[model samples]
Target chain A: MAGARRERDIHAATLELLTEVGYDGLTIEGVAARSGVNKTTIYRWWPSKDALLGSAMVEADVLAIRLPDTGSLRGDLESLLRQIAALLTGPDTSPVVTALLGAATHRPELGEVVRRFFADRLGRELPMFERAVRRGELRDGVDPATVMDLLAGAVWVRALLRGQPPRPAYVRETVDLVLRGCTS
Target chain B: MAGARRERDIHAATLELLTEVGYDGLTIEGVAARSGVNKTTIYRWWPSKDALLGSAMVEADVLAIRLPDTGSLRGDLESLLRQIAALLTGPDTSPVVTALLGAATHRPELGEVVRRFFADRLGRELPMFERAVRRGELRDGVDPATVMDLLAGAVWVRALLRGQPPRPAYVRETVDLVLRGCTS
Candidate 1:
């Protein structure tokens, strides 16, 4: 129990540092100082700074996402995309997420963690498509993974690349467009 | 002519050091050493490291993209996306682009440059959609900008976020899906 509590403290400190300093400026030493955990302990648990930050992101943020099932794929997708947009645009998470994204480009380990995090989130949302397929809202063989990528990826571009907030109307339109493509 | 040659050498050296050291470790001093140019001259033209690198990216690489007009929206989009995929996955440009992306998160000026770079590319491709609309291949009121974001953003996610190469087949399918969404 003590170990688990200490791990939580480390994750919290990691996130705090990420938000304050951004990814490029972040270091294990800062995490150690902030968390009051020895640098050696952090190193023992996480092989590198990338590993610790990635793990902290998964533990504190990514895994917390819950996709709403509104009894229809479109409804569920809209809800989920909205949530994702909110998360990305939120004050605390936005900077951290953006930093992690930038860091992932240069670091292979961080890239692996990021991919796994998305895979897990996408995996959880797969059942929404399955239910839609059963309901005949989507054609057979419609890949839920691709749909997730399209929806989430569209929002990502607007939010991250364009520096625009993913508004409700825009998310709805994107969902409609993807649903139209899948259904027709 | 000598001045132009010196500028070209600087851009080349910048890309080289960007690839070798990654973005965070890169410095104007290294660039000057690699290019045999004075640091003061580089600073005279570019105010900061971000400005210099962003300028180098624009001059040396981004302006090289060329999209073939296959006389159909689908054909043109597929060709453009394929080119984008290849560019992102290519060794020479990928690291530079990735580093720029990460750097942009912390630097608003770099972010502006990145946004303008994409916007310019998208603007260059908008005529293809216009041609399609005139040729009756697309519905009236189908927004080219949104379509661009959807298509390019999807590829970006697959390439950057997922660490998956944007294969030709996948690019084609994405185009087909988006076209279907817009048309039907």
Candidate 2:
């Protein structure tokens, strides 16, 4: 019980530091100080600062996402994307996500962590596309992975590269565009 | 004459250090040492480390890209995206681009620089879309900027998030999908 509590405290502190200082500036010492956990405790759990930050990011962004199935491909996509937009633009989560993306570029292990995180998330969401195919909304052999990449990628570019909040209208347009392409 | 040579030497050193040490580890003193230029000269020109890095990235990536104007919309898009894929996967430029992107997250000025760089590149490529519209390859009212975002965003997601190189087949598929969506 105490161990679980300590882990949560460490994750919470790590996330706070990620948003506050970003990945480049984030350090294990800062997390320890912020969480009031001993530095040795952190080292025992996570061998390096990158490992800790990667875990914190996955815990914050990936684990918590629950994809909605709204009985139609368009509905499911729009709903899922809207949730994504909110998360990407969320006050607390956006910086953390951006920091991880930035860190992933320089660090190969962290890149794997991020890639695995998304791959798992996309895997979880695969059923939505399968359902769409069953409903005759999508053609057979349509690669759900590619479609997911396009949809999510479109939003990510806007949010991260363009520095624009993923507005609802933009999300709708992206969904409509991808759906049109997939269906046709 | 000497001033131009010094500037080139500094930029070359900056790019080299960016790939070697990354944005977080790169320091003005290090750049000075690598280029054999005075630290004061770097400060005189760039104002900050972020500024120098941003400039180096732009000089490396943007100024070098040449968008192909292949007459057909499909041809133009495929060629352009292929170039993007090569650049993103290129050993020398990829790290610098990634570091700049990561640095841009915490540094607003660098973000603006990246944004402006893409915006300008998109602007240069808008003529291709316009030509396609003239040839009835696309609808009259299609927004070039939005289409550009979707295309570039799809590639960026794969390259950055998925840790996958944008393969030629993937690039072709993206172009076809976007074209299908945009036309229909």
Candidate 3:
């Protein structure tokens, strides 16, 4: 297999087993078994469990969220939120993240990784808000984190707390609600 | 201890142990040992671990959130968000809920309890929004769930995802944003 493909497989396998057995039970050998990639290859590419977890988590969450550039800010926000809603209700609910978060409450190293990973992911969404502000869709001085949090947070509240899939209608309303709040 | 105080202590101890040892490790005896109540007394009330956990989780999350009616919708919301922010950033960071939620993805019984607990908790906040709409503070037909998920979700996003405290200012901004969104 190609090197990039092998890396993708390894990361995918790592997350798969991570969700299944949790962070504590995850092993490179299991990842190798799942991915059919060599454990030695995984170690050679990523030196430690933290390194592997950090890379996989960042790759999965940040890399997957492509900021859609719809002509209007509403379109852009709606598009972005729809993707996030899907991820939140989809495979992203893997207990591994929850299990890791649960452990991160106690484990500082894991906690730091989880924190940095989300900070980076959340930060990446800032450009969308900046664009909206530039286009006069959002009021001047609107904070991206605040907007993003309200938007994504709505999806999360439903998915995480309620365990409900945030349907398409819900996504549209959330975008509309947040946009109105920010612009008006 | 009196009946109410004893029950409170039992729930407190149950949540404490649930966070420390998780739902799997939690037991009636453990609650008894921690709360200074006898196992027989605990069983006489709760009957099973699920029953005990159901009582404790609901008591801790729902019963703790007292919606302050500060006359206006804005004040009431701000007060409510402040209390929720405290809980989300405070002791509510207990891994037991996360652990139970994670387990709920696979275990049906646990899943129902967790879902019902949050639905009931979320549902209890509706009167505030109803009052707001009645007072003309919010637009007619504003869905309480949407507003609430935005408010509480913002807190959860900061607390759970970023591992950061939802400061007073953040809580205030969230209420402001959601209120503006709804009213405008």
| Candidate that would win on lDDT | 1
Q: State each candidate's clash count.
A: 0, 0, 0
lDDT, residue B75, candidate 2: 93
Better of 1 and 2 by TM-score: 1
TM-score of candidate 2 on Cα atoms, chains taken together: 0.81
After superposing candidate 1 on the true structure, give the runs of residues whose Cα lies further than 4 Å from its correct spot: A1-10, A21-55, A61-63, A181-184, B1-10, B21-55, B61-63, B182-184
> lDDT scores for all predictions?
0.77, 0.76, 0.74
Instruction: Rank by lDDT, highest first.
Output: 1, 2, 3
Candidate 3: which stretches are off by over 4 Å? A36-40, A60-63, A91-106, A182-184, B36-40, B60-63, B91-108, B182-184
lDDT of candidate 3 at residue B106, scale 0 to 100: 53
Fraction of native contacts (fnat) of each candidate = 0.40, 0.50, 0.44
Q: How do the residues B1-184 of candidate 1 rate in per-residue lDDT, one tens digit apiece? A: 2288898898888878877886677899998999999998888888788778767766775436776889878888899888877778887678777777777777776677777766777778878877887788876656676677777788888888887898988888788777665221
**Please, what are the lDDT tens digits per residue for candidate 3 over residues A1-184?**
3387777887788778877787788888898899998788888878888888888887753237787888677887788888878766665543554556555655567877787887887788777666766666776555678777788889887876677889999998887777665221
Cα TM-score per model: 0.83, 0.81, 0.86
Task: Estimate, for each residue in B58-89, the C-alpha lDDT of model 2 and write its tens digit.
Answer: 55433367867777889998898888777777
Q: How far is candidate 3 from the true structure (C-alpha RMSD, Å)?
A: 3.5
* Residue-level lDDT tens digits of model 1 in A41-148: 888899887778767867774326776879877788889989988888987678778777766776676788788877777788878877777777875555676667
